[model samples]
Target: MAQKDPVLALDNQICFALYALNRAVTARYRPLLAELELTYPQYLVMLVLWEQGAGAESARVSDVGARLRLDSGTLTPLLKRLEERGLLLRQRQADDERVVRLLPTEAGWQLQEKARQVPARLMCGLGVEPQRLMALQQELRSLLAVLEGSAPSD
Candidate 1:
């Protein structure tokens, strides 16, 4: 049998860390969301809509997918759920009907205060400062670019 590289060990894999981090974060959000009867993905969509919007300048499902590394098959269904919850409205663009725009409803903004503490709460657990977080995010972006058929230019 051929031997595997020591560096390829599971303990050294970033995917394992990412998986664990997601699971742990989801666990934290679960109890918090039970009060609002929302799921993690739903909350993610809300976060996108809050940060973006339903219009071109606001948000579209494709834009969300791009930012989240998802696709329409996954995002379209989630967008439907958000629409059903009255958290947002989904519609085809007037000029470009092919583009689906996701606009948050009044209820979505209404819940902002409810979740206002979540970002800081999660960050506190990660124990990374804002500037450090930005640096790490940039590194992750570079890593993602490398994975996505594009080597990040320095």
Candidate 2:
């Protein structure tokens, strides 16, 4: 039997580090989000909505999906659950029957206040300097853009 290459080991893989870190971060968020009755994905969706400026809050379902890099198959069910929880509303556009728009409910808007401190709390828990986190986030986004841009050619 051939020995496995050291370069192929799990501990040496960047993907493994990313996967483990993602899980750890999500685990850290679990308890924090539970207090607001939100799952991590739900909180992400809410973040997008909350960031939309005044009078421009509603977004097409496709738009939301695009922003989150999600597809209807995955996003639809999450939207439905949020709607059921009275956190958001999904409606078909009057002019475009095929277009579905997502609008946060008053409750959802109210919940934003409750969630305002989440980032700070998460940062404190992470024990990373804000500047370092921002730089790392920028690097990750750059990596993501490169990966996404290369996909069709692959």
Candidate 3:
């Protein structure tokens, strides 16, 4: 009988590892995010908007989409839901009706304060060291950069 091929093993697949890790991390965030009335994607969107700071003109729909690596189709529904919840306003630029700008509302800014505990809470629940997680995050970012063709290959 032929021996099993190591390359075909599920345990040896990087894609499966990443996929599993993504699901695990997102699941861990579920309850914490629920407290903020946000799903994982919504929490990511809010993080981007909050990082942009409080302003009349915070970010364009394109800017958010680019930062999140999401297409308009997927991002639009999330933005719409957030807008409907009074967390943000989507307004067309006066100069160009096609250009949509996102402005976080006061309620959205207030939510930021409550969300401040989410990261620490999630890390505590995972029982992982913060420094180790930071290192893993950097490595993932490097891998993503290469996959996106934004980084030089060895």
Candidate 4:
């Protein structure tokens, strides 16, 4: 009998692990986000907008795109839907019409209070220790930085 290549094993593939993890995490978020009437992508967009704070001040679409690693093709429709839902407003910059900015509406600000429990709720539901999750998150961030070519050289 010939030995099979261990490298070809699905369980040994980092890409498969990551893909499965992403799907599992998103699935867990589904019902929780449904309460807010948000899809996973929509929730991510809202998180960025919320971080920018509520006011006349806004975040540039490009800035949000960069933060989320999302291209306009995907982000544009999400933004449009959020805008239509009255959760956010998309406006062209006065100084530069070419630039589109985003700001959360009053309702969106209110939603933040409701969403404040989501993280804790999710963590509790997953039964994962916060410290362990934090460590995992840091490791993932490091890995992502390396993959993105932004990691510092030793």
Candidate 5:
């Protein structure tokens, strides 16, 4: 029988580290979002909408899905919940009824004001410098690109 390599242990896997970090970061966001009656994924959708500006026109559902890396199967229910809460509106496009558009409602815009401190609080809680965090994000983006085969594999 061959002995298992210690180098192949779970703790030594980069994928394990990434998975653990994702869980930890999402856990940190849980309570903060609970105050606003949002889950982390919902908060992410709102963030994308919020970026378009409070009074900005509606965005196509496909566009939102692309930005968030979510499929309709996943995004639809979240959008529905936000809609039920009067935080956003999902409408069929006039020119192309097959296409759906999403826009933040007045309540959604107001929620943004309450969410303004989330990032700062997260940074403080994590005790990480913003510059370092940004650098890490850039590195992760490159890693994802490689994983997705958009970047050359070495």
Candidate 6:
């Protein structure tokens, strides 16, 4: 009988480590964002949407889902909740009815100004230099890409 490799055990998985770390990191953002009535996931969606601009904050549901590492099943209800809160609008694209676009409302963009302080607050709490943090981010991103099988090939 072949013995299992210790390194291949679930306890040694990089994904599990990241999962724990991700939860811990997100915990830091919770109370800080309560003032804006935003949850970590909602704030992350808003961050991505803000980059897309006011009128067309979300190019496609798939795009946002991919960026956030979320599935449509999850995004669908989240988008609906956001729409209900009047922070964003979701509708099918004219060219492709199957594709939905997410557009932030005037109220949504205003939320970005309040969120601007989150990064600074997080940095202070971590007590790390910006360069160190950037390096860590790059490493973590690479780890995520590898786990998702999205890393670019040479």
User: Largest lDDT belongs to which candidate?
Assistant: 3
Single out the weakest 10-residue window by summed lDDT for candidate 3: 145-154
lDDT per residue as tens, model 2, 83-111:
99999889999998999988999999999
Model 2 spans with C-alpha error above 4 angstroms: 152-154
All models: lDDT?
Answer: 0.80, 0.90, 0.92, 0.91, 0.90, 0.85
Question: Could you tell me which 10 consecutive residues in candidate 1 have the lowest summed lDDT?
Answer: 49-58
The CA lDDT at 60 in model 1 is: 72
Work out candidate 2's RMSD over C-alphas: 1.4
Tens digits of lDDT, candidate 1, 1-154: 4688778889899889989977986897787776676788888777777876334476878889987888989988778887898888888899998998777788888887788887677677766688887897898889778788755564
Cα TM-score per model: 0.74, 0.94, 0.92, 0.91, 0.90, 0.81
TM-score-superior candidate, 2 or 4: 2
In candidate 4, what are the lDDT values of residues 27-73, reduced to their tens digit?
A: 99999999999999999999999998765468888888999999899
Task: For model 6, give the RMSD to the true fold.
Answer: 3.6
Lowest lDDT block of 10, candidate 2: 49-58
Best by TM-score: 2
What TM-score does candidate 1 get on C-alpha atoms? 0.74
Ranking by TM-score: 2, 3, 4, 5, 6, 1
Better of 2 and 6 by TM-score: 2
Off by over 4 Å in 3: 1-4, 150-154
